[model samples]
Structures are given as C-alpha cells and as structure tokens.
Target: MNVSQSADTVWNNPVGRLLTLLVGGGLVAGVLTIYPQLLPVVRWVVPVSLVFWGASRLYRYGVADSLSLAAGCLLMLGGFTYASYLLISMGELAGTVAQLVPVVGIFVEMFAAHYRNQG
Candidate 1:
C-alpha cells in the first residue's frame, strides 16, 4: 500500500484509537498535575459533559441503539457518588477512580461507535 493508505489504516484500527485515548488521557493528567488548581474545573466539566453528551445522544437516537450513552451516564453518576462517599468516609483514591471512570466510559463509547459503524 501507499504511505497515505498505510497511515490511514493504522489510525482507523482499534489499537490506534486506544493509543489516542491513552495519549489524550496522559496529556490531560500531566496538565492537571502541573496546574492542580484546575481540578475543580475538571470535576465539574466531566460530569456536565457526560450529562450533555448523554442527553444529546438520547435526543438524537433514543435508547434503542444507544445503550452506551445510558451506560456512560450511569458510569458518571456512579463514579461521582462513590467518590463522594469515599472522600467523606475514606480518602483520595476515590477521587482518582472518579476521574478514571469517564475515561473508561469514553473508551466504551468509542468502541461501540466503531463496531456500530462496521456493522
């Protein structure tokens, strides 16, 4: 194959998508680490974004084929609830997990979209 086609093929695959997610997550983490003050913004942004995304999907497609959208909302809610519980009763690990939940949800949604497009 030509160089352009080879590049497109690499980026269109699951592994490349995963790698992109990891790199994006890592960049966000690094930036947050550098500017700890942005934590509050991130906390709000994540949940709000999740809600908006879920709402948009529900509005556009309904639940029939958007299980992942519902799951993403649930993941966000569950993560935040658990994080809050942990913070009140335990510690920082919960906060870390809360941050990670949306990332995992995003990966799930991405794969779902990929497969849906294929099928």
Candidate 2:
C-alpha cells in the first residue's frame, strides 16, 4: 500500500495509461478551444511539466503521498481558476474551461486506475 507500489500499480497497465492520457489530453484540448490564450504555451508548459514531475515523485516517494498529490493538483487547479478569473476580468467568457480540464482528467485517471485494478 505504499505510494511507489500504488504508482506502479497505476502505471504498469497500458490500458490505464492510455485511458488517462487520452482523456486528459482531450479535456485539456476541449478547454483550450474556448480561450486558448488562457494557457499560454511558455507560461504553462514548464509549470505543468513541473507539476507532473512533482506528482510522480510524490507518488514514488510516498512523502505524504495522496496529500502531496492532492495539494499539487489543488494548487494547479487554483492557478487555472485564477488564470480564468483574470481573463474573465478582462472580459473573456472562455477561460473557466481551463480549470475544468485537469479536474476532469483527475477523475478519468482515477477511474482508469480503479477499473484496471478491478480487471
């Protein structure tokens, strides 16, 4: 029940990773379709990369494990929400979708993992 074990459980399955990647990418793309500028390439790429890396490390190390993941996710969610807010404040109606993408992706990932385990 360790974090590394959990991650290995999550990652070793091709179906699970594919499911997550497809779902996550689609969600992110869908959100971007609205206010694409909300996720400026340079501005978000590095941060997103870092978050993913950090999440993986947190998962592997089990250093507060789920808490670490949750916190990272929440922090990113908050950032996305805030970015949307800023865009909205500037009179845009398409930014909130950015916040929805990863949120949905998280659920997708969880479901995929659960289903994989069940099988």
Candidate 3:
C-alpha cells in the first residue's frame, strides 16, 4: 500500500479506537476530579446517560433491539432519580413521576425529532 493508504488504515483501526476511548475517559476523570460533588448525582445520571449512549452505539452497530431495551431501562432510572426529592417529602409516587418527566421529556423529544427527520 502507498504511505497515504497505510496512514489512513491505522487512523481508522483499533488503536485509534482505543486512543479515542482513553482520551474521553481522561476527560471524564478530570471533570470528576474537579467536581467531586457530582459523584452521587453522577451515579444516578450515568445509567440514564448510558441508556442513550448504549442506544446510539447499538443503533450504530445495527442493534436496534438492544437499544430499545436499554432505553426503557434508562427511562425507568431517570424517573426514579427525578422523583428522589418527592420520595423524601411527598412519598413514593410523586417523586417517581417527577423523575419520569425530565428523563422522558428530554429523551423522547430528541428521539422523536431524530426519527422524524429520517422520514
């Protein structure tokens, strides 16, 4: 292969994939280090984030079924977390509903918009 093609192959290969993962991981580490207070909320948020993250990854990998499952799980977690305060104050139902609002509202709207454009 020519030098240009060789370089292009490496750039698109597994090593390059690892490098991107490492860089993104480092950025997350740095952010957490700078904002330790995020730990608790992050625990809850990560799963929700992963829901979309996993969904997108699955979609990219041609795994729509997996994305659908993960998305459902994510929405459930979001509702629970969102209603945390309500759970503490008003009891279970209200707090849970609150969590659902933010999670469902944001993800669903974005998801709908995404698919709408495809059609």
Candidate 4:
C-alpha cells in the first residue's frame, strides 16, 4: 500500500522458491552421487544446475530497476560459477555446499525482510 512496501516487493522474486527446490533436488542428487550406479546422474545434475542457478539469479535481479540488486546478482553468479568448479574437483561435499549455501542466503534474506517489516 505504501511506497516502502511497494519497493520491498520489487526486490522479492519467486526465484527464492525455485532456489529452494533446486537445493532439495541437489541434496537428493548428492546422496545419489555416492553410489557407483548413480555417478552418471551426479555428473549431469551438477553442471546443469550450476548454469540454471546462475541464470535464474541474473534474470531475477537484472529485470528489476535496482542497480544494487543487479550487482549483487553478478557477484553471486561469480561465486556460484566458482563453486561449480569446486563441485567437480572437490566431489559431492563441495557440490552439496554449493547447493545449500543459496538456501541459507534465501533464509537470511527472509529474516532481514521480516525484521525490516517489524521495524
């Protein structure tokens, strides 16, 4: 209703929900990665998810009028791209961390929004 609320909504994106889903799927794929039979699945999922996640962040923030958000998205994409490299070299743990970190970020964002709303 107010200008502040409208601005807050602008920064919000359904990408958070998609991010959460990817995290969950990544966890499942991670467990599968441990099995010799499932190694093929892991190989495919890791790179694909990395690309998808990066693009999602860019698309979510780049469309907004906020330059800061676009910058943040670019930074996140850089970190995420590096982490994807770690995923392949460092094995399942690295991949799992890469996937889960964004989920933590999403929660942090949610908490910040909640606190700001309270204030």
How close is every model to the real structure, measured as TM-score? 0.46, 0.30, 0.36, 0.33
Compare candidates 1 and 2 on TM-score and give the better one.
Answer: 1
The 0-to-1 C-alpha lDDT of every candidate, in the order given, reads 0.68, 0.59, 0.60, 0.57
- Order of candidate numbers by lDDT, starting with the best: 1, 3, 2, 4
Model 1 poorest 10 in a row by lDDT:
78-87
Off by over 4 Å in 1: 1-43, 75-90
The TM-score leader among the candidates is: 1
Clashes of each: 0, 0, 5, 0
**Residue lDDT tens for model 4, 13-96:** 577556667888888777876676877665565445644654664566464534434443444554575456554576677666
Cα RMSD to the true fold for all candidates: 6.2, 13.8, 9.8, 11.0
Model 3 per-residue lDDT at 20: 70
The full ranking of all candidates by TM-score, starting with the best, is 1, 3, 4, 2
- Give candidate 2's TM-score: 0.30
Please report, as a residue range, the 10-residue window in candidate 4 with the lowest summed lDDT.
65-74
Error of 4 at 2 (Å): 21
In model 2, what are the clashing residue pairs, if there are any?
Answer: none
